[model samples]
Target: MGLLFLTIFLTDFFGYTDALLRFDRVRRKVWMFVGTRSPIELDWDRLTPVSQGITPANSNVNTFRSVLLVDLDAEGDVKFDGKYPRIASIGQTSLNEQQAISQYEYVRQFMELGPTHLPSCETYLEHRTVFRDIVRFFGFLDLARNIDWRRPGETGGGLLVLASILCMLLGWAFLPFDLATYIAYRCNRVPKWPAKIEAYAKDGGEMTTPVGAASGRMRIVLKEVPFILLWVGCAFAVYAWVASWFIK
Candidate 1:
């Protein structure tokens, strides 16, 4: 069970580094790369943005997804090189049509008007650490997003508040998986862009490092240490109690 858990986390951690699409607004081009294949370069004008949606066999609600179809061969038909298409699934998937459009608009606006006048993006986790990796694996960021600290008490008063509390209490159940993810992340490496793509990106100007937010290490120590220690202590106690039955 432990090995299987570690394998799952490792696969997920490394899967994200296998393929990437680099959109260069400055050069008005997009680079499609997968593994060791020669990267496909497409002009921004040739790429068509299409919104797609699907209803799963078991589900009733439609889940919307967006993609940019790039015409590799200006003649209108998609040509495959050996296996994969030249470019595929270029945009973020969303829950609904509005969200899909909003995601696209965010990219479009950034492409057209630079980074100014847009809602600030979440501050990137500049460097990876065990705590940050664990936070990501357990979806702490998602929980934080749902709570909305900026407008406290605005997400309803009674039931919603109770639900959030319950959600947090249940979140600790994934401690084993989160710890496995940290191990996988510690061994994983970030994917490097191809030399050609790197050169192209550096053509106009060097890419700047993203601004990072406070890591909240101090806050975690002060507010969360006791809870974590308590959880670990309880887990060990339960293990010992269970093992004692076998000993008898």
Candidate 2:
């Protein structure tokens, strides 16, 4: 049992850390692509380039394309031409300047409307906050609250606690079965008893009536059996260790 605990502690600790690092790296890449300092300030304008090409139909009329010009720098500057020239200002109302303005306006609107109808900064921040919250919640739910046998603080402190507990459990017991059940629980596989009760209450009907009651009762056995096995294994291991010492 001691050996099992040790094994479980090591594997779970390292595996969880590895997974977290991988997630962090992917998140960073996503932020980088979106032109945000963190996941919190994504500005679409900074990420996407303004349009410079003119439509085939508008090619004949230089003024027509010029009329579509947009002022990106807010100084009424930054003009575009057929060559897509990057210039300082859109001076003098000409066909080229108009075209540049049009392109800028088009790109600006596109950025503004994309990504949940939020500005670059707001969108990025919202997404980051949501992502962080979800990950944190699940980490707590899976690693902190749900244990097969051991207590919460049995594992090391900090982020290692979850990993350590996981390792210890896996090393000392038949972890595959326990792990499957844990997964199911996290996925909310339990039947709809709560929904049924709420419906009855709303209708002024018998709120005590069971809805999906049979399914919930049946799943309890599957949910609890692993914890029992874990406890029994741990106890037997402790007894054997003490017995060995006496023999020696």
Candidate 3:
């Protein structure tokens, strides 16, 4: 029934097609609604992609969390502080690498062309990837299914529980980073944050600066001694609490 309603009336937004857009030509902005949450409005004048790249996915490597990082000017008018620019990331748990790239391309193209961009797919792959990313969200059920009481065997239950916990941790930890990136970008508060994340993925990060200094300042603020200490402290505290639940 929900799907039916969306198809009949909200298909454009769900399909991520031309219909999702609400343009005010005089204002020179565009809107996108993904159905489950409030729509996102974009002001083309203040948009720019600071960087775009992805890390390879691998199960054995804890650091192999795939990501695409982008910087935006949040408020879309002017920066209050020269010291602060904004950053947001997209990751594999939320989307495969291909989908993140598509997002960049779409936003980049949309800003470049104004509302006339009209949400297009250059190829079938592009369409398939978008729909696939949207559907992959439902994949979270797999974690819950693993926790079913009907299941037997320590290995199965424990592994699934651990996977679920890690998933939650990933989101919790990403929250600050993601919030820092988009909170100031839009005109109104977004209902749900962007699921995109640039996973830490590899040993040393690959970051490019399109308009600002070479991340030295951001590193000091986001990754330097003080923040890193707080992050590590919180992570250990959470791990200890969760471990206590199962150590017995």
Error of 3 at 142 (Å): 10
- How much is the lDDT of residue 121 in candidate 1? 51
Tens digits of lDDT, candidate 3, 1-248: 98786664443232332234443344554444445655455554544543343345754433222232223445454332233322233323323445655655665554456435646332231111221122111243233333445545545556655644554555345434334323222212223323421121121245323332232112122212332344345555776788999997
Candidate 1's C-alpha runs over 4 A off are 1-11, 17-19, 62-64, 72-76, 135-172, 209-219, 232-248
Minimum summed lDDT over a 10-residue window in model 3 is located at 126-135
The whole-model C-alpha lDDT of candidate 2 against the native structure comes to 0.35
Determine the C-alpha RMSD for candidate 2 after optimal superposition of all C-alphas. Answer: 23.6
Higher-lDDT candidate among 1 and 2? 1
Clash count, predicted structure 3:
8
Q: Pick the candidate with the highest lDDT.
A: 1
Tens-place lDDT digits, model 1, residues 58-130: 8887665665554556677776667877555645677767777776677677677776656755454433555
In Å, residue 85's CA in model 3 sits off its true spot by 2.8
Q: Using lDDT as the measure, what is the rank order of every candidate, best first?
A: 1, 3, 2
After superposing candidate 2 on the true structure, give the runs of residues whose Cα lies further than 4 Å from its correct spot. 1-204, 208-235, 246-248
Highest TM-score: which candidate?
1
Q: How do all models score by TM-score? A: 0.68, 0.15, 0.24
Task: In angstroms, give how far residue 55 of model 1 lies from its true place.
Answer: 3.3
Q: Evaluate all candidate structures by whole-model CA lDDT and list the values in order.
A: 0.60, 0.35, 0.39
